[model samples]
Target: MKIILISLITLVSLVSCSNNSQVVSPKLDPLNQQFISEDELFRLVLHMDKLDYRSDEKIQLHSTLEYIGTEKKATIWHGMPYINYLITDGKDFSVGGVVSTILKSTTLEKGEVYTFPYIKTGAFSENDPNADFWREFFDEKDLYLPPGRYTLTVYCGFSLTEDVVNSKYNNKVEVEITVD
Candidate 1:
């Protein structure tokens, strides 16, 4: 009787464990950002937000115009770093998943510039535990504006990223940027 009882208990435990199933989102891990090389070319990256999206297709590309400090934590502390920002189709594809950002920025001594490449793919699941770095940046932002021209204007209107910003976005200067 003891042996039979033990077998029954084990079978019940296995059945209970087998019945558990859940869907979870992946996490957006941060990228290991570094200088790809010395002569890397950088262009201006603009996020598609706060304006008329003149394009019919979704997904716009953008870059962050960051202000650099002499002794900041996230920078080499030489000059301002302009990062490539992307305003993806996240809004229309809410049912879709998170997008990862592999942004890179380098500053030239005489030019005001920033650039990054955007590869818009599926979104990440919060429960996915193994989402990539770019995915983390993608999952953080809840809103993705339509295709249009806009400005950085102080890391989204506040000084949250000021330590990483160089004296550019604070003026709320909206330059003419277009998306297709």
Candidate 2:
């Protein structure tokens, strides 16, 4: 009995010592909007390494879109890429499943434009929107506001490897934007 108790204690100590540290840091908002503030024509570029594509098909990196129409429209749009979306109620936010995009083997820059196109879930009608904002992905549309200051969050997972399928990565960003 004494030997068994000693062995049990030793096993417990070994288990405690092997914590298997998994450092999950809080997400950092690093949106590179150094030049344009409100209604300026600009583009967005997102980087992806093959592993981030959780889709049934192999995801692609390096894509573009004509999001910024003109300097006065205050319009930016991208097709949904992920499954999480959020709606804001002043201070807090309402979360939902929405459209989001994934990238692999790519880099984002100021001069790049990314476009995502989606049809609104409801039936097509004069009163229907061409696309669903938060219903698809977490973009500006889900926030639902008139014109004010707000913060936008994007969650990205990444992985880079000689065989991208074997690498691992996570990338997310938040942006300070104005409604108009």
Best by TM-score: 2
Candidate 1 lDDT, 78-169, residue by residue in tens? 11122212233323322221211112233233243333333332334434454454355455444343354433221122222335355333
TM-score of each: 0.24, 0.26
- Stretches > 4 Å off in candidate 2: 1-90, 95-114, 117-148, 158-168
* Residues 1-180 of candidate 2: C-alpha lDDT, one tens digit per residue: 554456446544543454322111233232333222222333333322322222233222222222254333322222223212222434633333232222323333343343322111211122325335333432333223434454443332333333435653333334444444
- Global lDDT of each model? 0.32, 0.32
Looking at model 2, report the run of 10 residues with the lowest lDDT sum.
116-125
CA shift of 96, model 2, Å: 5.4
Off by over 4 Å in 1: 1-58, 64-108, 119-123, 126-180
Candidate 1 least-lDDT 10 residues: 75-84
TM-score for candidate 2: 0.26
What lDDT does candidate 2 reach at residue 169?
34
